[model samples]
Target: MSREFEIAREFEVDATPEQVWDAFTTGTGGWLWPMDAPEPREGGTGPFGSTVVTWDPPHRYTNRVANVEGIAEQTLNQLDYTIEPREGGRHAWVRYVHSGIFVEDWDNQYDGADKHTDFYLHTMREYLTHFAPRPVAFTTLDGPEASKAADALSTAVRGLGLAEDVPAGTTVEVRGPDKGLFPAVVDYHNPYFLGLRSDDALIRVFGRNHWGAPVGISVHDFAPGADAKADAAAWQRWLDEVFA
Candidate 1:
């Protein structure tokens, strides 16, 4: 059995539809939403085209989005916005319609649609609510021992761009996977951090701060066979330059 599903969410942005439309159609605004690299153009790039399908100025704009990767092959997505006049500005209701079919099993398609809708609504709400500048944090660590490693990592993090007054008592030790060679362990603030590793090299970086204000971390592992010492020195210099 094959199944299909449809989902829709609505929001009221403080800006006018024209303003909202610009944001929706422009690359800067696209970053605020879910699109990775949105290029608004009709029969061009991005979810929406170049010109507005229903350009009612401060009232509404409806557009069709077809040029997606995986979803484009099986689905048709249309976004419609209806803006109503309000006290100080306009109230915008965004309706996203996704109509598609499943050539295989309908149950999975239905469940997937449900999940996708939930994610879509959540993403939209997050963008609208937090339309402000946020900070991005990166962290790294180095050391001869585990404890020293943690301290070195802390130094790297502070050196990068994070506040020096990052919360204390938020560090923990983590072990690397077994692959023959020196055992590797790390001090970390959160598990979501990224880690990179190679013979004679280890680096960790915290990507971005979540809404919860927790620091993300990543570790890099590297150890050269023949040029181990030189490789390690080069890695340290790279970190220094990046954090500096």
Candidate 2:
């Protein structure tokens, strides 16, 4: 069935409004996955292939994509960001909206997008707080077929010494790719999403079993030695062992 949804969220980040503006226009890699640089003016193309609808530096930027492929019923996909400086410009308040018209696999597409948005935004705050301006090495990998099991996500979290009920802002220990163990904070958690942020990275474990798919993880590594392919392979090995 066709569905329309708007996800509106407001959060404070430990960054200036200018830094927040760069996060959307140029520095997305510091928070979200990297993308081609978008043109800076209205009528220019955005990094995600959307047309820039509005562009006002450090304040408002909106983009829209029309007639998405493979989704014949889709009409529009738009993203809007509004930033306001606060606390003497030491921090910023961000308002984000993702509104779209498309087909919905309510169990997966709609809900997954909603929850993943929270995790990504949480990562944005984490990045601005601890690792801003450092380019991150981001990589994503899918787990083995066994990861499709209902308990798959819970299993991995337990392996990290965390319960699904762990509250955010709590500190915990998690195994690193090379180091024996490293510290991370529970940045965000929900039934379908788990986010952990360490001194130099953000780790997101997605529970996609509900979508009839394998579980997956995305790492945003900002350490000086970060390498995307190498890091992804290392995590792939860990995921395989977790579900084996």
Candidate 3:
């Protein structure tokens, strides 16, 4: 017999419903975790080859995944997103639900998925609050490790001189592995995540473990005519040095 699992999370964002919808549909470079955009209709394909099941504008959307890349799977995964206006249309309320059926090891699988969900939601808030309507490009770089705990990754990221907690609108600067100084304002900060927004780019550093002990870093470049590939390469080099 196949077992089933489901998890739901809600977020309060300081943006309008229209703005949140655009981020889901168009401003994918600013969010969506660097994944490809899904078509605005039923049966559309999303990043990692997931299929869209629902696409309602500025209200609700859902996508389903049956086959996850590079993993042995015996279950189905479905992701649903809902958006509602708040404070007389000045702000928004968002909910994300992940539901599916699992054959075994349900606890571990669900835990991993739940942890990453928090980071992605944080990215969405960062984009809507400061970087919306800007031409943004996103790049994700992965470190070579496996099954890392959150506390361990946090220690490593903090040792690099990045702030553990920062208030919004604070000016800050940190040197990359190449000794290059990048400056930005603190858009959001948490125990395992850091979001920075600048005139030139939006930077997010995620110390949460994904698959193994690996730490993921994503950069969202908002500069006009910026080279996303080049920026990814530079950040990749920096990550390699720091995690080496």
Query: What's the TM-score of every candidate structure?
Result: 0.40, 0.90, 0.81
Superposed model 3: Cα runs more than 4 Å off:
1-3, 44-47, 102-105, 145-159, 163-170, 186-191, 209-211
All models: lDDT? 0.40, 0.83, 0.73
Q: How far is candidate 1 from the true structure (C-alpha RMSD, Å)?
A: 14.0
Q: 1-244 in candidate 3: lDDT tens per residue?
A: 4677888899889999999888876636777555677877899886577898998888998988885665564457788989999999999999989888766666666666676677678777877877787776778877655415546455444544565555667887767656777777776665556666777777777765633446777788888888878888887777666655
* Local accuracy of candidate 2 as per-residue lDDT tens digits, 5-74: 7989998888899988887878456777777766888999876568999999889999888876455646
Q: Which run of 10 residues does model 2 get worst, by summed lDDT?
A: 102-111
Ranking by lDDT: 2, 3, 1
lDDT of 3: 0.73
Per-residue CA lDDT of candidate 1, range 117-138, in tens? 5443443343333331222111
lDDT of 2: 0.83
lDDT of 1 at 35: 36
Once fitted onto the true fold, the runs of candidate 2 whose alpha carbons sit more than 4 angstroms away are 69-75, 177-179
